[model samples]
Target: MDFDPLPDKPAPDNPSGKLVLLRHGETEWSRAGKHTGLTDVPLTPHGEELARNAGPLLSGYDFVLELCSPLERARRTAELAGLHPEIDPLLVEWDYGGYEGRTTKEIRKELGYNWTPFTHGVIRGENSPGETVEEVAGRASRVLTRVLPAMAEGDVAIVAHGHLLRILTSVFLRMAPRFGAALTLDAGSISVLAFYREEPAILTWNHGPGLPLKPSES
Candidate 1:
């Protein structure tokens, strides 16, 4: 387990450390395919185990910055994974407003038409007033502002929920925030993003245990 921390962050061979994203393991609502936001839910037992195993994937690096959503599920996952991340409100899941505890299927059935958070939007709810995709993207931008600079020092880690991470990824890649819909991130999954010839690129996507996570070729 002897290794260098890659102190030469900008060495010719390795231009900068990668941005590693660790999506929190499954929660009751997430497992049920419900829109989870604002509400702080705990992880299922299996989710705890998943987070334990996910630790090793990130063990090799010394992250200059580690951030996690304040929600219990995300915080629990970060603790289990030994991330010791700072609480980042910007990393919280997208505020689903009135849809907090409901599923897209149910909402669409009730509305009598197809709908999605990115397309149909959400209504004001008791817990949250709902946020537009643009608003979500703005938060993602703020996160990047702090994280991207840290990359020059070493890798940065983020332990958070799904939709927020995907939206952040889109913003990092200079894609429209709605592009997040095309990216599927599963609970307990790991993803890596870094620069490719001066442009942001995805080095790995939706990686999980029993899978390969070789060094980024970026």
Candidate 2:
């Protein structure tokens, strides 16, 4: 139920077809800041309220397609946002494997293991193949490829998780997946990313709806 404030400010505004990225509402795992990759947990009560409010916040955008992870949190968020998302497995979070349901600190001390999907690979657990950061990034890139053809027409809304979304951003920016580790997105937050002359530009990141400034105002 604790998270550090955003480490730094969001990127400056730029001109590009808007790609609205929404992280799903909070889960017990997310509220506790534990990795919820592929866990399929439902949203907490507070999370539902936030997701419902997002409908008005994002009503202005002309989203032609709603691509979402099959996980309950994301699908519920998309539904609350007044859109029906076509489930995309690639949109799911990184597989946490043995780390699922456990905090990073707890796992670190318990196993004396310090592994990051961006650097060290996820070990066997959660029925995941223990995918590495590069592998995860490739999956994200495939999603981008699926979405690009539709990008030229209307805005696209991606309802997904924090780490996976960050990885998707890296793929869009043509950066390695490890670079995404530096980009921190909050739970129930919205991010806008787009391209100018084929160059990636991040219009926003880690924006909280419950914060005084709404997404439209920001």
Candidate 3:
């Protein structure tokens, strides 16, 4: 809850701060390539293992603020990762609306054309009323407003969903929300955002525990 107010403009020299972004472990829906928004799903056993393994990767950092989505998946991932994070609704995943339980392939089969959440958006349905890319970007901006101040103190960690985190990163870099389409975040992966030469930059991205590293790098 404690964070600094957003400055009208960033300082020219020192970096603003670092943000450590993490996507929750895999869920049945995620494994099936279904759009999961506002759905409360638990992680698979393998997913739990993924989260546990991520602990050591994050244990060394000193975070001033730690937050996670209220969804069970994100909260559980944080716990498994050895982090006690506050719940932040703003960190929830994109509202997929009518596409809630469907995959792009299924949707395409129905629509007779390729469909993507990033460009076409979602149709408002009884079960799921989808959100626009711009709307998602707006929420991402609000999240930055809260975390930027905390970043001034030290690093901050946000455990959230794949789509939301990517959009958040795009907003962090002052890029269009659609640009998030280019960033692929795997389940239980960690990405780091920091300042380079006093400008926002990605220090590391989509690093999974299973990734191979050279002896010296490891």
Candidate 4:
């Protein structure tokens, strides 16, 4: 259970604690390949099992600030994972808007060509207007401002959706938010963002329950 993968910081006193991301477990929409932004979705029974198991993987870290999206799926995952997290509205998923409940394949078929949320973009929805990738990046920046300080204090964990966390990872790495489209996160996965000598780096990514790092890799 040695989780010592992080490298040394450039400075001793200014060490920033790692940012641990916990993606919420599966919901009906997620299982069905539907876009699940803004709409509140509950976790499936198997999803609850996934959350409970994720708790053990995170038992090593002393998280100072634990945040979860206000969405039910994210909050329920945090709760089941034994995290008493503060509900952070900013951690909600990408505002899929017009595409809220539709799958990417379905959208593409309807449009008669390829349509991607990150690249092709989303229009205003029936309930609320969708957010552009850059807008999501802006929100990610604000979240960093709030969490970076806490990271310096101690490790921080966020329980949220796939798109939101991936976009946040891109922002943290100083990349275009749309770069998140290249990253894929599954339900009930863990990703760690820590410093590599004071510069941001991804320590581990998309570590799902079924995957394991080889001994030498760890």
Best-matching candidate per TM-score: 3
Give the per-residue Cα lDDT of candidate 4 at 91. Answer: 91
Candidate 2 error regions (>4 Å)? 1-16, 111-115, 211-218
How do the residues 16-74 of candidate 2 rate in per-residue lDDT, one tens digit apiece?
34788998887777777677888788988877877887777688888877899998999
TM-score of candidate 4 on Cα atoms, chains taken together = 0.89
Q: Check candidate 2 and list the clashing pairs.
A: 1-31, 1-32
Task: Quote the lDDT for 53 in model 2.
Answer: 74
TM-score of each: 0.88, 0.85, 0.90, 0.89
Model 4: lowest-lDDT 10 consecutive positions: 1-10
Off by over 4 Å in 3: 1-16, 211-218
lDDT of each: 0.81, 0.74, 0.82, 0.82
| Model with the higher lDDT, candidate 2 or 4 | 4
Q: Candidate 4's C-alpha lDDT?
A: 0.82
Name the TM-score of candidate 1: 0.88
Clashes (N, CA, C under 3 Å) per candidate:
0, 2, 3, 0
Error of 4 at 147 (Å): 0.9
Pairwise TM-score winner, candidates 1 and 2? 1
Expressed as tens digits, the lDDT of each residue in 1-218 for candidate 1 is: 11112122333443388899998887777877788888888988878877888899888887989999999999999899888989988888888899888988889999999888877778899867988877888888888877877888889999987889988888888778888888888788889999887678899998876532222100
Tens digit of per-residue lDDT, candidate 4, span 1-218:
11111223332444579899999988878888888998898988878878888998899998999999999999999998899999889899989889989888888989998888888889898788998888877777778777877887899999998999988898787777878988888888899998776788999998877733211100
